[model samples]
Target: MEKREVVVSITDNGPGISEDIQSRIFDPFFTTKPIGKGTGLGMSISYQIVTEVHNGSIQCISQPNQGTTFNIKLPQKYNRVIPQ
Candidate 1:
């Protein structure tokens, strides 16, 4: 069987996320924003979409004041061909 892989990355220049909380960023309702500012489901939903729906993987890399980056990898395989 032949398989293809796709990689994507997203980066931000704002105040980077801390190391202590980086692990829980994908958890449901986990946010560092002020009250009534965020719902905290964004990362959780994204994690589900990539890992569960697409059978892919997601990860985050960040430092206190440097920045943050999200790396995503997805499998690209087709079992049949379609006429174009």
Candidate 2:
């Protein structure tokens, strides 16, 4: 069967993420913000929803001082039931 997907791209011109931190951005409880300023669950939850619930993919592309981009691809049609 041919795979069909919808792509979403988000970009930011602000200072981009460093290579060291990029790999862990989607990890639960991982954040670079000050202790009281962030819960660190945003990205982790986003990753899970896209990959698990939607059966899709997400990727981050960044270069320090240049910019950052996030690309998400979701299947055009999904048949599986969401987890409880």
Candidate 3:
């Protein structure tokens, strides 16, 4: 499937996270963002949706003071029809 070709990335200009903290960024309810600004479950739930539901993987790239980027690899087509 062409969908197997991994792609997609998200970048942010905000302060980058430390390696220690980055490791846990995808943990349930984990977020570097301030309370109310984010729900803290975004990345965690995203990980599950990509890997478990879509059979894909996600990665983070960052350096202190250099901002952050999230790469998400997913299938182009889903087994279950998704509402547009």
Candidate 4:
């Protein structure tokens, strides 16, 4: 069977993220927000859902002062095993 994928892109016009911080954006408990303002689990959870659950991929592209874009690609069809 031929493999197919669905691509999604989210972009923001706000100041883009720095390279140093982008590397860890998907790490659990890694957030740029101030203390008590954010838990930093959002991205980590999203990454897990896309990559593990759906067999997809997620990436972040940005440049300082330019903008930020998140690209997600999910397989159109995936196989899941059911255990009795």
Best by the TM-score measure: 2
- Per-residue CA lDDT of model 3 for 1-84, tens digit only, reads 344445998999888978998889999877777877887788899899999998889999999999999999876664665798
For model 4 the TM-score comes to: 0.88
Over the stretch 1-84, how does candidate 2's per-residue lDDT look in tens digits? Answer: 889898999999989999999999999999999999999999999999999999999999999998999999999885565798
Clashing pairs in 3: none
User: What TM-score goes with each of the models?
Assistant: 0.83, 0.89, 0.72, 0.88
Give the Cα lDDT of each candidate: 0.92, 0.95, 0.85, 0.95
Task: Order the candidate numbers by lDDT, best to worst.
Answer: 2, 4, 1, 3
Residue 57, model 1: Cα distance from true site in angstroms = 0.6
Worst 10 residues of 4 by lDDT: 75-84
Clash totals in order: 0, 0, 0, 0
Model 3 / residue 84 / CA error / Å: 12
CA shift at 18, candidate 2, in angstroms? 0.4
Off by over 4 Å in 1: 1-3, 78-84
How do the residues 1-84 of candidate 4 rate in per-residue lDDT, one tens digit apiece?
878898999999989999999999999999999999999999999999999999999999999999999999999764654687
Candidate 2 residues lying further than 4 Å off, grouped into runs, are: 78-84
lDDT of 3 at 54: 84
